[model samples]
Each structure stands twice: as structure tokens, then as C-alpha cells.
Target: GHEHSLTGHKQRGTVLLRKMEISVAEADKRTGKNTVNMQETYTVYLIETRPAESVPEGGTPAAPDTLWRRYSEFELLRTYLLVTYPYIIIPPLPEKRAEFVWHKLSADNLDPDFVERRRVGLENFLLRVASHPVLSNDKIVFLFLTEVMNNLEYFIFFPETQIIALKIQTRFISAVFSRRFMGLKHYSDELNTIILQLLRVRARVADRVYGVYKVHGNYGRVFSEWSAIEKEMGDGLQSAGHHMDTYAAAIDDILEEEEHYADQLKEYLFYTDSVRSVCRKHELIQYELEMAAQDLTYKKQQKEELATGAVRIFSLKGMTSKLFGQESQEQREGRIAALEQSIQEGEEAIKEKDAECQEFVQKAWTDIERFKEQKDKDLREALISYAIMQISMCKKGIQVWSNAKECFNKM
Candidate 1:
């Protein structure tokens, strides 16, 4: 899951440290024995170890559980002996571990040189086992060894290999749910386990093979073959995983868009409802104001009619008597003045109300347009961003898939 660039450094470091420790032990042992020279051997071992430390740690960290202290020259010696040990003397019984090793060695389908070496190792190992008194009659050991060798041969001969076989296993899971291969319709737990095991082995071997190829700088037939296998499995695994990731991302984007749109729609609905409510209230207010204006007009008309009637009565009175006519004239003038002032005030009040209504109508139109424009801009930007993101994602996927395909072809 994490980056692994520094892994090479760590492995080389551990190996060198082991070599140093072995040298120290050997030097100490020789010192105690008096016949051995530590000076020449120690310097040679140190020289052999110099370049190992030069390999800097790359990007990855060493495993936490790994015990570097446990690695020693003795361990390396032991491994070398184990590798070559079968040829020297086979155990009383066919060693299960040795069989596993031979299986891996044979699985390479490597050159004749390697094949010949492995054949010699196995034959000698078998001979050693047959020479053992306790293992001479053990048919089970022979059968197991034969099966191991056969599988190794099969693996080597196979044209393609899956690396994620270890992950395809089915266990004691509920029958309601199951995982199956792309073409397979039925479930077989045993087959799944085997698949997963093979994948693990494939991954391990591929890493080692790649390392060797890189170090040797030979990119010919063998490198190409191994690379092809790496590509095949890597693509298969990545494809299976990538599809889900892409789909999930797309779904998330859609949901986010939906939520944003829903929020805007909600706001739009709110404003629309407000506008409708205001319009209804405005209509009601307009109707009431109109009724009030009509009432005021009627009142003014009634007042004017009374004033005219009074003036006519005063004129008739003045015709009958001069003193009474003078007093009635003054009264009529005052009444006319009061009625004009009242009418003027009423007209001014009506004008103010009309101006307020007009302002409100203008504001409502402007606000609606502003909100619509803002929403349009936001939607446009969102769509553009989404389109760009989709394009980028597609490009990335294509590149990854192509790289995987190329790897497989080379392998």
C-alpha cells in the first residue's frame, strides 16, 4: 500500500550487516585458535561490505517487526549450505522445505544451466534420502517430493500467471454471498485458496526477478518474459480495483451536484413564494387604498354640495336682509377655504401611497433577475469543472491501462 523505493537499500543493508557479523565471529574464532590470520581475511570481508552501505535508503521504511540483529554471516552461510546441501547429503526423509525450494527453482523455466544445476541438486538430494536408513522405505515422502517437483515444472511451463491469486480465496462464508472468477459460475473454496497462494508466490518472484533484471541491465528475452507476467497480473488487479474507485468518485460528484442544485432550488422556491405572498398583499392593499380614495372623493363631493347649498341659502338670505347677507358671505368663504385644504391633503396622501407601491414593484423585479443571474453563473462553473475533472480522470485511467497492457505484452 505504501511506496517501496527504499526497499532495495534496506535489503542490501541487512545483507551487508549480516556479512559483517559473520566476519567478526569468524575473526574471533580464529583469534582463539592461534593458527588463523584475521588481518587479511577481515580486510577482505570489509572491502566486500563497503559498497553495500553506499546504497542509500530510498523512499520506503524498513518493516517494524524485522530483526536486523538476527541477520549474521552465519545465517548467510546457513542459507548457502541449505541451497547446496541437498547435493551433498540428503536427509533421512525427503525434506518438505527442500521440496518447496526445488519447486520454486524449477518454476523459473530458466536456461539449461540452471535446470541442470537444479536437476543435480534434486537427484543428489534423492540419492541422499534413499541412502538414509529411516527414509529408505518412506513412500509418502517420495510422493510429496514428486508432487512438489511436478507443480514447479507446471508453473514454469505455464504461459501466464496471476499475481492476486492469494486474494481470490473463498472460506467459510455465508452462502448468501460469494465471489467468483469472471468466467466461473460456481464456487470452489479449495481452488480459491490455491489461486491466492499462487498469486502470492507470483508477486514475490516477480519482485525478485525485476530486481535482478535491473541490477544486471539485461532487458532481453528473460527480462521481457518476466515483465509480461508482471504486466498481466498488475493490470488485472488494478483494473478490478480502479473501476470501483472511478465509479465511487463519479457517484460522489453526482451527489454533490444534486445537493447543490437542491439547495439552489430550495432558495428559488422560497423567494418565489415570498414574491407571490407580497404580490397578494400588495393587491389587497391596492384595493383597500382605492376604496379609501373613492370614499374620500365621495366625502369631498358631499362637502362641496353642502357648501354650495349653504352659499345659495346665504344669497337668498342676503336678498332679504343686508346685515345677515354680510355675515353669511364671510361664513361661506371660510367653509370653502377649509374644504379646499382638506382635499389638497387627501391628494398628497394618495400620491405618496402610489410612489411606495411603484418602488416595491421595481425592487421585486431587480431582485429576481439578480438571483437568476447568480444561479446561472454558478451552474455554468460547476458544469465546466465537472467536465474537466471527467476528462482528466479518463486520461489517467487510459494511461494506467495502457501501461499495464504494455507490461503484459513485454512479459
Candidate 2:
């Protein structure tokens, strides 16, 4: 489909963020199909915008882009962005709207008002994603905003390619034959190298996650030991006829710092596990790639052998078999198309994995910054305050002892 405009403006500069609406009611067969399939209806988000930077003065204002995305799709897009841009904090999705009484799994989720609530949530979600420093520049946000088409049909048929293809493969075929036609080994090698690097980084990321958890654990121990010491000091100060609680106020700051650290540690741990899952997913994809390359190579070799007349022929029956056994152009194209689709899918999968990695690493970096801020700076200041309090308390104790000694001498 061509993006033809009546006003003849094909490409606009930057589409400014203006308004977004969630379209609950629409008269389209696709939306109808969606409603029927899910037994519940979903809404579309209409992103209205005027290209401020791109449009010329007095030029015709183009129509707003119509975008329809399901809640799951919105979730997927958010996850994709999170994976792609690690540092940016993705905006949260709208709460699941219920049309009726609150329940875990209610059909009310599909109600018009409920859907509207969700639409607003999703709109907010997109705006946040677009306004962010790093995420705004990403093409994915643009694609999500501009593309209205649903790929439900594509996903349904895509997995079947593997099943249809597995029948074409029986056992391990020689890389030699396939290499003569299409370069499977090269692609495989390149992928292997890239995946290996990713795997190594993944392992390091896992280690970092574990390391942060250990730091949090060690801090817990520090708090325990500090509490015990504080209690002992409290008893001593009380016995010395001083108010220990006044000096103990400094411990509250320390306690708050520990809480902050604990929260940060939990966030890091979650991302760590998330990145590990992504790595496992990619590892599985790598195996699939190897097997897929084998399948593509098989089709390629048969096509090449038939074209060159390299397939052996001993008798008239054998000749007939050889001629008939030659792969047809259509089948060749299908295999080639399959390989391309597989590659495209792999690339998309990688984009997700890369984003997860960014999320993992960015959290770690941000944690480091927080550590410096909270533990290094704030904690140090708190400790100094505590020390000053201890010094002042000791001075008070010294004065009391001196006065008591003076009284005893007078007695």
C-alpha cells in the first residue's frame, strides 16, 4: 500500500505529540475478528498530531494516523522498547479496566468505558515513551504509532513453517553440499560468533546481578551488627544517666538508606532474571538457526544439483526419477522465502534480547549511581552526625562524672 496523500505530502518531518484516543468502537472486520476470537473487544489508539517541524506554512494539514493495538501488543511494544533502550524508564500501561464489579477475570474488561480507561492508559503510555530522551528517537515507537495493521494472521501461520519444514529434513545433512549452493555455513558461523559474544556478556551480567544481591545481603548483616552495637551503647549511655534515644536518631537515616538499597537490589534482581530469560531464548533461537540453515541448504542443494544435472542417473527409471526429483522453482522460492522470514524473525528476536541486556546493564549502572548517592554520600554524612552525637554525649558524661567527683570530695 502506498501512503498517498491528496495534498501530495508524502513524508512529513517530525510528528509532534498532540493528542491520543483509544477507539473502542470501529466497523472493521479485523476488529470484529479480534472481538470474536477473544470473546471480548479491544480498542484502538488514534494518535492525532500535526508535524510542527516538517510541515510548511500554509501547507495542507495531513490527517492523523489511526493506530490499533491490543493490550498484549502494547505490552509487547513496551517490552521491546525496554529491551532496545535500556536506560529509559518505560511508562507503565493502563490498569485493566473492568466494566462490572471487580473480579480477577471478568468480561467487563471489554466494556466500552473500561476500554476507554485502557485507551487513555495506553495513550499516556505512548506519550511517555515518545517524550523520553532515548526512547523518543527509536523507530519502534514511530512504527507502533503509525502502523495500524495487525499481524495476527502472520503469527498464526509463522510457526507452521517449522513443522512444514521439519518434514523436509530427516537427519543431519552435510554442510558441504549446501555450501556449494547457498552460504549456510557462513551465516551460521557469523551467528555463532555473535551469539557466543552475547552469551559471554550474559554470563557477566548474571554475575553482576548476583554480586549486587551479595552487597545487599552484606548490608543486611551490617545493619544487624550495627543494631546490636547501638543497643549495647544505648544501655551504657542509659546506665551513665544520659538520654540515648536523642543520639539514636542518626540510626534512622542509616535505616532509611538500607531500605533504599534493599529496594534497588530487588529491582536489579528482577532485571537480572529477565535478561537471563532473554539469553536463554536467544540461545534456543541460535539452535533453531542452525537447524533452519540446514533446511535451507538442503533445498538449495537439490535445486543446484537438478539444474546442473549432477544428480546421478544409472538407468531410464533413474533418469526419470532424477528429472522429476529436481526441486521446482516455486519450491526453491518458498524455501528462500522461508529462510528470509526466519532471518527477519531472528533479527526481531535479537532486538528484544538487546533491549533486555540494556535494561539489565542500565539498572546496574543506575544502581551504582544510587550507591554513590545514598551509601557513599548520604551514609557518610549520617555516620559523621552519629559520631558528633557520640562525642557530645561522652562530653556530657564526662561533665557529670567531674561534678559527682567534686560532690564526693566535698562530702
Candidate 3:
């Protein structure tokens, strides 16, 4: 069913990343079907949106709008988008509960570091959606970015008419240009396995790396104490200790930066599910078409048997007919008429399902191609960045030790 658009405008806009402010508020929780419990201490993000810099000629640029959105709301928006556009690879949201967190760090959702990471992730999600060629034009996305709402429940409940029209147009285009395309089921399954394994191994490696850097802190402490008792080597030992301390302290910042790359990998990991969903939807349509064709074939066989007055096979209907006496001529004619009507309906259903399947496959394959290009570009950049960061960290470690060595040589 078509629904009224909240805002009539469908113009694409830009989402700006503004600083997130933590607000403590009482949230009403539904403990049961009719129960309302007050939950305290929830985090909300301050999102800002503005008209794109390249506004059309003679068009007035709208002032930036700021709205306080909760993390759960972001989850809601993502869920809505996934259901609405199953073919498109929707941007993944950050992990709501911090996983594989350092032992020293607070694992709580409201932890400052965790919240900050989530804020960055949420910002990226918005930017990705805004930049999507098709998603950017969606009214729901536009409303999510620009509209101020006291209650978010009302926001997604209404389906926009523009979206219905878009779907209709998409179906028509798909039907005209439809062709057989390879399914992503096998590809997505393999990719998911590889990504999960990588994430697991990377997590273990990161944990060990964290411990190794932190162990340097002990070396720094030991050197400082040794310097206090030394005569000729005191200054040199102290300088070396300082470098050790600096290297140890740098781990926190370095690891935090590395988390960003992990997030990028996680995005594609989540994307595998979306790709599989398209394949599953297509399978369902294919199944329906098969069922319809099978039903039609049975009806045709029944019509042939009635017309030929064929001897009864060992069947429940045939046995009943024998016991009650053969069906009258009018009864037989009526049965044939019913079967003929059913056959016609079944044929029509088969055609409709086949067309629907073709259209879906075409549309889904088109988006998959687009997503593949994007995935290649994004993963390439992410891997390059990760390599560079590792190189830079190693260089810094070398520089620290080299400086420590020079200090000892001067002594």
C-alpha cells in the first residue's frame, strides 16, 4: 500500500559530521505488553545536516539543522533501510556492544572511548547513505537527516508514495532489460567465511600486540630506576627510559586508529548478509513459479483423463467415484470447466512469477555489480591504510630505540 510522504521534498542533501554530546535521560521501557519502566542513562548523538554546497542556481541554501538522535534510533533507521531496499547494500552500523575490547578498557556501551568510536561509525553510516546514488534520493533518508521528531516510531511507519513509484519504475525497467545472471549465494557464503576468519585472527593478533607494547612500559620503569643509581650513564639511561615511555604510551592512540580499519572490514562483513538476502528473495520467487507450473501441468493431465474417459487408476477420487457410481455427464462437464478455469489461472500465475523473478534478478545483479566495484575500491584503500599505519608504527619504534642508542654512545 502507498503511504503519504512526511515531507513532499525529495532533494538530496549532505550530512555533516558534528561532535556528539552525551545526554542522560529517562527512557520508558516496555517490560511487558502493558508495562512501562523508566530506564536511565541513555546516550544520544547530535547530528547536523545541511544543503549541499552545489545548490541549484537561484535556490536558497537551507541553514544547517541539528537533531539529537539516540544510538537505538540509528539502529532503527538501518533496519528500515535494509527491509526497504533489500537489493542495495546498506551501510552497516557500528557494533552496539563493544566486542574484543581491551581488558583495561571499559566494555560498557556508555564508555567514553566506546561511545566515541560509535559516534564515528554512525557518522560514516550517514555519509555513506547520503552519497549513495539511489539511497540519497529516498525521502525516508532525507527525513531522517533533516526532520526533527519528538517520537521516532512515527517516522518509519508511513511508507512514502515516492518510494512506491520508484519501485514500480524499477520493475518496469528490470523487465525490459532482464537477463540471466549468476547468483551470489555461493560467492557471499565463501566471502563471509573468509572475513570472519580474518576478524578472529586479527582480534587475537591485536590483543597480543597490545600486551607487547604495554610490556615496554615495564622496561621504561626499570631503566628509569637504573639511571637513578648510575654515575656516568645516568643521563643516557634517563633519555632511553623517556623514549621507552613515549613508545609505550603511543600504543593507545595507535590501537584506536587501527580500530577504524577494522570497522571498514566489518562493513563488508555485514554486507555479505545483504547479498545473501537478495539471493534468498530470488529463490522464493523461483520456487513460486515452479509450484505454479507444476499445478498447471496436473490440471492439464486431469482434463485429458476426463476427455478420454480413461480407465480409473488406483486413486482415492477414482475409488469414490466407483463406489458411488460414475459421475453424470453434467457433473463430468462441470468438473472439466472447473479444471479449465484453474489451469488458466495457474498459467497466469506462472507467467507473473516468472516475470517477477526475472525483474528481481536483473535489478539485484545490477546493484551487486555496483557493490562489487565499491567493495574493491574500499577494501583496497583500507588494506593500504592498514599497511601504512603498521609501517609508520614500526618506524616510530625504530626511531625511539635509535635515539636511545645514540644517548648511550655519547655517554
lDDT of 2 by residue, 23-124 (tens): 223312134554446653445555554344544589865654465556677767765654443333344565554322212223465555345445544554
Order candidates by lDDT, high to low.
3, 2, 1
Which residue ranges in model 1 land beyond 4 Å of their true spot?
Answer: 1-246, 274-285, 304-342, 361-376, 386-411
lDDT of model 3 at residue 113? 69
Model 2 spans with C-alpha error above 4 angstroms: 1-31, 34-40, 53-62, 86-88, 97-107, 152-411
The TM-score of predicted model 2 comes to 0.31
Q: Model 1 over residues 281-397: C-alpha lDDT tens digits?
A: 345335445756886796587566556563333455546555544446677677668777878877887787677656655653454354345435543554455456546645755
Colliding residue pairs in candidate 3: none
lDDT of 3 by residue, 296-378 (tens): 88889889888787744568887787799999999999989999998898888888888877777777777788788777777
lDDT against the true structure, each candidate = 0.36, 0.44, 0.70
Pick by lDDT: which candidate is best? Answer: 3
Clashing residue pairs in candidate 2 are 83-355, 83-356, 84-355
Better of 2 and 3 by lDDT: 3
